[model samples]
Target chain A: MIRIEDVSLRHGQTQILHDIWLTIPKGGITALVGPNGAGKSSLLSLIARLQPLQAGRISVDSFPVDTTPSRDLARILAILRQDSIVTSRLRVRELVGFGRFPHGRGRLTPDDYAIIDQSLQQFDLTDLSDRFIETLSGGQRQRALVAMAFAQGTDYLLLDEPLNNLDMFFARELMRSLRRIADENGKTIVIVLHDINQASAHADRIVAMKSGRIVADGTPSDLLTPKTLQAVFGFQMRVETFDDMPVVLHFR
Target chain B: MSIAATKQASKTGWVAGLTLAVLFVFSLCVGVDDMPIIRLFSDGRALELLLVSRLPRTLAAILTGAGLAIAGLIMQTLARNRYVEPSTAGTAQSAELGILLVTLLLPSASLLFKSLAASAAALLGTSLFLMTAHRLPPTQPFLVPLFGLVYGGVIGAAVTFVAWQADLLQYLSVWTNGDFSGVLRGRYELLWLGALMVVVAWMVADRLTIMALGRDASIGLGLDHARMLQLGLIIVSVISALSVVVVGMIPFVGLVVPNIVSRLMGDNMRGTLPTVAVSGAILVLGCDILGRLIRYPYEIPVGTVMGCVGGLIFLWLLFRRPSHV
Candidate 1:
């Protein structure tokens, strides 16, 4: 379980995250949904130890984030940031292979290669494995980045806006892949998402935030109501049942 | 196709290595005193000339070429810009300042002492450059190298003023303008240390490439980004400073060779560094040879030749990155 307590962040006088407490259990998909500047990414970053804990304690599977060695933490947790720009001309396979870096001396054994191959297959990136990342389309490159994170073989995966470049079809496919991984592999996934429908469709639990505070936390049906939506997003959106899942029509 | 590319890369490595070896042996025979290939074993004078002059010059040229190229590659990786080499980042200029200070303060200091001091100075200057560079908004990647160029210019201008005040203009020119015409056995051995540093670079090539992925990604992969940044700066400084103290500053070996090799071989540093190093040797040795032959013993400095050649290639590199990437 990942536990965050009294976490707060400030950049100069501007507060990015208020005193926040969240506990994310192991072995399922948890989605963080919020409006712009809702501190969703900041909360995830703190959980993954990407940003240093400014005023609170965070522990992942009993390992205190700030105190534990990074190498040890890396084995248990993997994170994919939204603004990852790979300037190096790395082939997709080589790029994915870096996920194994914390495991060994950077040389991949056959078992590691098997894991890498599996990750590539998972993301539908096998065909593009040999292509340089620079040559990949934005969506394809995003998949490669995701494959790299998956190949980390960590217990918990923290992905901030992984669906940014992907279109609807690919986005659904990626969400389905995450769902499968959570079901079969029993990995814990903490994803910050802009698409509430995808989160409702795929996420096991939804955590809603506004102005650096978690305003609602429960299953999709509990959090997607018109009253909760208005309280969280500051706007009214119609929520309807689709295939027994609450799908919000926020565009109109 | 990946297998084929791997095979192709290995093939390229072999061909480059063999060609460099042959050219090295051939360069051993190119100087003022004509020592034919057959006479070295039979003639003592020819053997002396070979050991005392041709061999050291050839080795120095190759090592300087290889070292500067690798330094440039590491610098670019650390800076995350194709345009910033050690020369552009104030590293080489700081090394010059080191040499000048030592010359004024300790006239009797040995060559080894001078080179070490220069390396130390280069390390400090480059470290400061990278630290301040960290503060610049990363959205404007172009600003980093431009900042480096201006940073290097300020250091260079300081170096010039110091030299002028001390009436050490001639000494400054000798260190600034790279040449192998004066290389002899005892004079150019420090570059062997530079070669050893290249091996160190190769050992950490994977980490270096990881570094090119930017800070968050690199740290996410369990690398201590701060330590790796220091290691990179040290390697770049020591190598570039060694070349500066040994043969002055060969401008483009580090800047142009890696860019060209990366264009061909992608940025898997472990796989591409040998090719980069060998290609650097080729460029420097080729230019040194041209320098020798162009003036027909009257001689142009290798630094001058590279400034013209590398400057042109760098212009192409500058304009190419945005459109190409």
Candidate 2:
């Protein structure tokens, strides 16, 4: 479980996140959805400790994120940011192998390699294992990056906008993979998603943010309503039931 | 790594080793002195000349080449820009400033103390560059190197102005134009420090490679990114400072050699570092040989030779493809 208390972030004169207090329980997929500038990404970065917290307390599984050694925290949480640029020309397998760095430092044991192989297989990256990352398409690269985080073998995965640049098929495929990992492995996933329908269809719970504050938090069925969408996005959204799942249609 | 890649890497290693050995022998043999190759074994005077002049000069060239190349590699990785070499990033200029300051303030300081001062100055300069780089917009990657070049030019100009006012312009010019003609047994010992830095860099190769994944990924991988960055900066500072002090500023060797090696082999520093080091040494040896042969007794400076060659290559690299930077 990840816990946040009174987190506030300011960039220059602008406040990015204001008094964000949220608790993400263990062993489930929770999707954070918001409009642009709603601070969804900022909150994710804060929880992952990618950005330093100015006024907040965050803990993952009873370990304070600020005080815990990075290596110790890495075993409990792994984050994949949207703009995690890899400038080095590394093979896909090599990139995934880096996920085991927290465990082995640099020298990988046989067990670590087995786990790496499992991660590659889990993401269907076996065929592209030896390919350079720059050669892959955007969706393939996104999958590789996610696979790298998965290979870390952390109990909690925090992904910020993983669906960016992904086609509809790859986006659904990635969401399904995240769902499967959550159900079978009992790994907790906190993902920031832009597509509300995807969140409604795949996520167990949806947390909506507006103006840097959490406005709604509940199951997809409760949160994905026309009135709630209007409050969060400041525009009316059409919500329809499809196969017992509430699909948000905000495009029109 | 696959079996084929491992085999290929070893093959490259063996070939590079053999070439370096051949170049080392050739460098020792071809000098201004008329000592016969055969007489090197039998004649004491010829052997002394080889030991005192040719051998030290060859070793100095090799060390400077390897050190600057490795320094450039680290800087490029840290800056996330291929064009950020020691000279371009103002590290060499900062070292020059240190030399000028030491000459004025502590006229009788030991060579070791002078090198340390220069190393400290290089560290300061590189840290400043890193801070400025961190604040720049990442959308235009070319701006990073452009900023470095401009920043280095400002530092270089300031050093030159101070040297002129102090009536030490001649001294400054000699150090600025890198030449191995002054290298002898006693003069080239500072390069050993550079060799030690290379060894240290090799030991931390994996950590350095991990750093290339950028800040978020490095931290995500449990690396103390700031500490690793500081370590890399220190290594780069020491290497750049020592090379500048020992051999003067050998431009483009650092930038060109590492870029070529990275293009051929991937950026896994553990796998590619030795090759980068060896290639740097070979390039310097080859250029020094060319410089010696080009003008005979009136030898051109290796720095000038490398500037010409490296400049052409750099321009080609800039225009060759539409890079991310």
Candidate 3:
């Protein structure tokens, strides 16, 4: 479990995340959904230790995020930020191979190579593995980045807006892959998602945030109601049922 | 295809190694003294010149070239901007400042003492540049080199002012002009420190490449990003300072060689380091030879030749479409 208690972040005079208390259990997909500037990414960054915690405690499994060594945290958790810019010219396979650095320290063993190959295959990048990352399309590069995070073989994965720039098909495919990984591998996935329907159809639980506080937290069935959507996004939304799942229709 | 790629890279490495070897022989042969190939064995004076003067000069040229190239590669990787090198980033200027200070304080200081002082100053200057770079917004990549140039100009002005006041301006110019004409066995042994740094760089090549992936990605991969960056900066400083103190600042060997090698072999540091080093040596050797031949006995400084060549190449690189991922 990842436990975040009384977590608050302040940048100068503005509060980014205010007293965020949330517990994310192990071995399932939990989606964080919110409107623009809702502090969803900030909260995720705090949990991943990408940003330092100013006023609270966060722990993954049993290790404290603040004091734990980064290598130990890396083994337990891997995070992929949204605006990751790879400045070097690297092949797709080479980028994925870097995910194993925590284990191999840049010298990949045969076992590490197997894991890398598995990650490439998992992300459907086996064919493009040899290609340079700069040559890939935006969505393909995004997949490659995710594959790199996956190749770290961590038990917990924290992704901040991984669906950005992805087309509908690739987006759904990525979500499905996340769902499968969660179910089969028992990896805990905490993803910040922009699309409510994606959370509705895939995420086991949805946490809604607005103006730096958690407004709602429950299963998709309980949290995807029109009333809740309005409270979170400050706009009217229509929630309809499809295949026994609530599909939110916010667009006019 | 992967096998073929590796084979092709090795082939390129071999070709580069061969070129360096040929240049080494030519560099040993082309000098003021007529030391023919056979006379190296028969004549004592010829052998003495070859060992004490010619050989050291050639080694100094090669080591300075290769060391600065490696230093430039590390700097570019750490800065995540191709335009930042020792010359542009104020490393050379800071080193020259260190030499100036030492000459003022300890007028008769040994070469080792001078090198130590210069390396310390280089480290300080590089660290300041890195700290400033960290504060700047990442929106503009070009701003990095510009900041470096302005920063270097300030340091250069300071050194010049001090040297001019002390009436050591002529001495300072000789130091900064980067000619190996004065290199002899004892005077050039300090360059071996640079060679050791090159070995250290190779040992940590993987970490340096990881650094090029940016701070978040590297930290995400469990790398001690801050520590690795510090190590890289130190390596760059030591090599840059040593090169400046020994042969003066060989302009653009670091910037051009690494960029060219990256264009051909990609940025996997493990696979590209040897090629980068060899190419650096080759470029300096070729330029040094040209410098020797251009005026025969009088000889232009290698720094002047490289500045012209490196400036043109840098302009071409600036106008070309960026290939960074």
Question: Looking at candidate 2, what is the lDDT of residue B50?
Answer: 89
TM-score of chain A of each: 0.98, 0.98, 0.99
Question: Could you give candidate 2's per-residue lDDT for residues B1-325 as a string of tens digits?
Answer: 6566668778888888899999999998887778898877899999899889999999999998888889999999989888789988899999999988998999999989999999999999999998999788888787898999999999999999999999999889766878899999999898998999999999988889989988988888788999989999999999988887878898998888888877767788899999999988998888898899897877999999999988998788768756545
Candidates, DockQ? 0.72, 0.77, 0.67
Estimate, for each residue in A1-252, the C-alpha lDDT of model 3 and write its tens digit: 999989999999999988989999899999999988999888888887777789999999989998999888888999999899876777888889889988878788999989999999998999998887888999999999999999999999999899998999999999999999999999999999998899999999999999999999999999998888899999897999988999989889
TM-score of each: 0.98, 0.98, 0.98
Q: How does model 3 score on DockQ?
A: 0.67
- From the highest DockQ down, the ranking of the candidates is 2, 1, 3
Specify the highest-lDDT model's number: 1
Q: Write the per-residue lDDT of candidate 1 for residues B1-325, one digit (tens) a residue.
A: 2797799789989988998998898788787778987977999999999999998999999999889999999999998877778877899999999999999999899999999999999999999998888788877877888899899999999999999999999989888889999999999999999999999999999899989998888878888888999999889999989988888987877888999889888999999999999989988898888888897877888999999989898888777775753
Spell out the clash pairs found in candidate 3: none
Model 2: lDDT to the true structure = 0.89
Can you tell me the CAPRI class of model 2?
A: medium
Pairs of residues at least 3 apart in sequence or in different chains that clash in candidate 2: none
Reference-based lDDT, residue A49, model 1: 71
Question: What TM-score quantifies how close candidate 2 is to the native fold?
Answer: 0.98
Which stretches of model 2 miss by more than 4 angstroms?
none
| Docking class of predicted structure 3 | medium
